[model samples]
Target chain A: MQIMVNGTTHEVDVEEDMPLLWVLRDELGITGPKYGCGIAQCGACTVHVDGVAVRSCQLAAGDVDGEVTTIEGLGTPDALHAVQEAWIEHQVAQCGYCQSGQIMAAASFLETNPEPTDDDIDRAMSANLCRCGTYPRIREAVRSAATKLMEA
Target chain B: MKAKTLAVAALIAATATTWAAGETATTTAETEAPSVSVADGLEAWSRIYEVASHPRCSNCHVGESGIPMWSGPSYGKTRPHGMNIAAGESRIGAEFVTCATCHTRSTQGNTVAHAAPRVDMDWQLAPAQADWFGRTSQEICSQLRDPERNGGRTAQDIAEHLDHDLILHWAWDPGGGREPAPYSLQEHIADVMAWGMAGMPCPNG
Candidate 1:
């Protein structure tokens, strides 16, 4: 089982049906990504499969032949990636727990729609639940990050 | 700062009162008494257990990261649920974009913002870990006291949240399709208020 997460390749053993989320959280001890809802209905378990934000909870372990990036790999806490930095500047976290999944979703959404409209954000982020009512803030942070990314 | 504090406090107090009242409404004696008569945490913990386990709460108390989550079915042939809606990350339905698309907020006594059927406060599930799916009341009591696991909410915050949050109260008066928590919102509050006053004990076994 050769898989690269954040540029590190690792061989692991696990059942095929086990979702990638468990592979990250249990097999690899990557706890940054949370399990809000497992059925892929909630974006809390979102991670990158080849740079696209797909609910890792929905993807089985066998689905892991592609490149993966968890929140930990998104960037360092001290020196964040553009999206993370943008999240900080825009104050995206409330519980701060859902930010990882939200960030993953936003980053992936922006990749395809660099200049996303409000509807784009609403559609892209509609899959994630903040529980804290942080939707408005998330929308703003995403736009801010997109601008920052475009500038670079 | 005051407005924010008040808002949070009001949200906390209002929800808590509504939840508590819903749980223990039969106690006219309690209601006739002053509002200062608070409930204990253990008692509240039990009711919270019932509510958290309810579909309203349990549906969202998602398990061990990456595990599959649950969602209600759409309208039509769906027996358990009538709506064809799906709760994406927004918890507000992916394709449908209307606060009223689901349920009106104020008309019903529930937690607003696409609120629940009706209640004294808003409605939703507890934190994932606090979920009571086949779990015991003692287990829930213990979970509420923990910070790291409870989304960093402090014991005081938990007490306040349970006590005042209108959503917490909504569990009792959940419009339909489900049974209300075991106790009335008032009784639930008495238990929670007592729990906080009792040093928020976790029923040390």
Candidate 2:
């Protein structure tokens, strides 16, 4: 099957039921999307499928109907996505293991809700779990990201 | 049970003879079959309720909550499905994460332990209108008979839905460590057809 990840289409031989996360990390070696919980419970494997946020860990490779954009594909070193910039400004990362997924989720969320309220940020970001308890900063970053996206 | 079967056979024979005689068919089967009493229909309904109310079936047949449940002996206590999942308005989780994300549609049975269960049909919560979780026998019986609440399906339509719906079949043959619903799928459908034939009598009625 052909899977486009990080702006590059890759032809891969894998089971259809294989999670898109595995296809990204193992098959294509795009490790931006981390696998926290194999189930859709944890948002650590969150990615953008045609600009909509989806848990890649739960999405089967065969079922991927759109182009996938992971944290790596979100922005470049020269020009980071608004969410990435906001993350740095808010100092959202403590351990940084779940940051990529967090950034991806926020980026995707801001696309649809460019002017989200604090409550909206909380509701959306709460989907992704962080053991270090960086939710306060995460919310701040999402708020900041929303502002940046509006300006841009 | 044997007596009921014989009575039903006799009723069928009588009905067949009545039709063959070419006497203008006037009354419905409900009026004609005195031997197949309302008691028999209610008894069959009890069995149908048994399968419908089982956790395997009712867990996903949630009401306005939109939160499917996870129950039976395996889970220790009856509780909502994990991950704070909601089927939302779509009833397929299109708003947040789709049920298909884990419960992939496949003809093959659930093989992995502690993973989401799957059937050939697309995994989804039963319509809010068809909510059966925590309902009484009378409430469910009336709801099933009422065309308004029952998706406007007649008795035959209900029987056909039961026969063709793979998710209902999954209740009886749910692979994995989960306990299957009380009776076989055929038995449940047969009960439904019998109860429907007898005017779908409620316990109190």
Candidate 3:
């Protein structure tokens, strides 16, 4: 099957039932999305498919009919996305194991809700767990990113 | 399939014998054996309660919020579903991230632990009216009989739903160390059919 990831299409041979997480990490070698709970319980494997944040671990590679975007594709090193910039401004990473998923989920949330209240942020980001309990900073960063997006 | 057919045949025979004995005796028997009476329907309901209240079934059959639960034997702590996932009014998360975005419509077995289990149907929470979480067995039984609360489904439709819905079948075969609902799927279906055949009586009724 051919899947477009990070604006590039890659043809890969694998089982249709193989999770998109494995295809990204083991096959195509895009390892931004981590493996936390293989189930959808944890949002550690979050990614964007056609601009919607979803658990990559639960998504099948063959079923992906949308353009895929991982944390790596969010921004270039020189020009970070607004969420990434705010993440750095807030110093959001502690263990950093779940930061990529958090960033991805936030980016998608902000796309629809560029100016979100605390409750909106809570409802949208609640699925992404940060064991370090960086939720306060996550909220701050989302607010900061939202401001930047509004300005842009 | 063959076993189910035989079970249905046996049930018919049992119903016939009860009818031959007359309605009065069957209704007042007070015995545990299957019979053609309101008591039998209530008894079947008790069994249905056991399965419907199990975490595998009740977790997704949430209240008006449309937020599925995460409580069960498998989850050490009973809490809201992880990832703050909400089904919204659609009960499928179509307003935001769709359930099918992660849950596939393929019946492929999910053998690995902690992985998203797959079913051939679109994964979603039960409708609001069918919400069973935190409800008593009597309440659930009453709700099931009400056409307004039960999706306007007839008594026979309830049996067909239990017998045919793959999402419901997933309750019996949920992988990933998750405990399944009480009783085998076949047994649950039989109980549901028997309850419907007995006029879908509730304990309070």
Candidate 4:
């Protein structure tokens, strides 16, 4: 089947039940989305499918119904998305294993809630687990990203 | 099909014996139950109740909490579904991560240990009005007989729904090391039909 990932459409031959994370990491060689947990419990495999955040590890390849966007597609190194810029500004990464998913989730959350409160940010980002305990910085980065998005 | 026919025949014989034994009619004056004795209907309903209240069915039949439960012996301890999952008002988890993200639709049987349960139908929680989780048998019986909370479906309609609904079938044949609901699907359907024919009698009535 043909799937578009990060602005590139590629034909992939795989089993129907294979998770999208496997397709992205194994087939397409896009490892931005980490596989913290194969189950949906961990949001380390979060990505945007038509701008809606979904856990790639649990999403079946055949079930993908829209354009896929990983952290690679979220922004370029030269022109980072507001969430990415905020991450650097606030130093939200501790070990950085979960940073890509955190940024992706934050970007998607800010899209629907551009002016989120602290509680809102906490509730939204709570799904993505960070073992390094970088939540304070993650919250600050989300707040900063919301400000940057508003300014733009 | 044969099992259902035999169960219904047995129910009829039981109803006849109860009537012959001078069983006082248990249904209220307004009850729509036919010739079947209230005693027999309630007996049949007891079986249906077993299946309805089991964790396989009631876990998703939640209330306003919008949180489906993960209970039964398989889960070890009765708790809210992990990961703070909420079905929201949509009942399909549309506002956040859709239930389809994990519970994918599939015709194949569930053999994966500890994987999210899968069925041939779209994954979703029962409507809030039909909430049955942690409810008593009497409450579920009343709700099943009432048209409003039961999706405006009469007892016969409810019986047919139990007969053919794929999700309902999942309750009886749930794989993944989960305990199937009590009694076979055919027996459940027969009991439901017999109960409906008996005017959908509630336990109290």
Identify the leading candidate in terms of TM-score. Answer: 4
C-alpha displacement of A152 in model 1, angstroms? 0.9
**Fnat of all models, as shown:** 0.00, 0.05, 0.49, 0.16
Model 3 chain A lDDT-worst window of ten: A111-120
lDDT of 1 by residue, A1-152 (tens): 76688889878888765667898899899888898766545668777777766667656576454789989998887878788887887777877878888888788778867887887677667767788888888888888888988998
Question: On residues A1-152, what C-alpha lDDT tens digit does candidate 2 reach at each position?
Answer: 99888788889999987888999999888888898877666778888888777778767787787899999888998999988998899998999888998888788767756787786677566678898999999999889888878887
How accurate locally, in lDDT, is each candidate? 0.57, 0.75, 0.78, 0.78
Model 4 chain B, poorest ten-residue lDDT window? B20-29
Model 3, B1-205: lDDT tens per residue? Answer: 2223212432331222211111111111112434456777677788889888888999889988988888888888889876667777888875444676567555455677766666767789898988899789988998998998998987657865665566777788787788988777656766776787678888777
Candidate 1, B1-205: lDDT as tens digits: 1111111122222222333232432221122222221233444454556655655455545443211133332112313222223333334332222212223223223222221253322223344465545456677667766676777775445554555555555555655444555655544444544455445565553
Interface RMSD of each: 13.4, 3.8, 2.8, 3.1
| TM-scores of the models, in the order given | 0.45, 0.77, 0.77, 0.80
Give the alpha carbon lDDT tens digit for every residue of A1-152 in model 3.
Answer: 99999999999999987989999999999999999988776689999988878789888876776899999999999999999999999999999999999999889878866777887788778778899999999999989999999999
Chain A alone, TM-score per model: 0.94, 0.97, 0.98, 0.99
DockQ of 4: 0.22
Where does candidate 2 stray beyond 4 Å?
A48-54, A60-66, A77-86, A105-125, A143-152, B1-36, B105-108, B119-122, B163-166
User: Looking at candidate 1, what is the lDDT of residue A70?
Assistant: 89
lDDT of 4 at B121: 68
lDDT string, candidate 4, A1-152, tens digits = 99999999999999977889999999999999999877667789989888878788767788787899999999998999999999999988989999988888888878867888886687677778999999999999999999989999
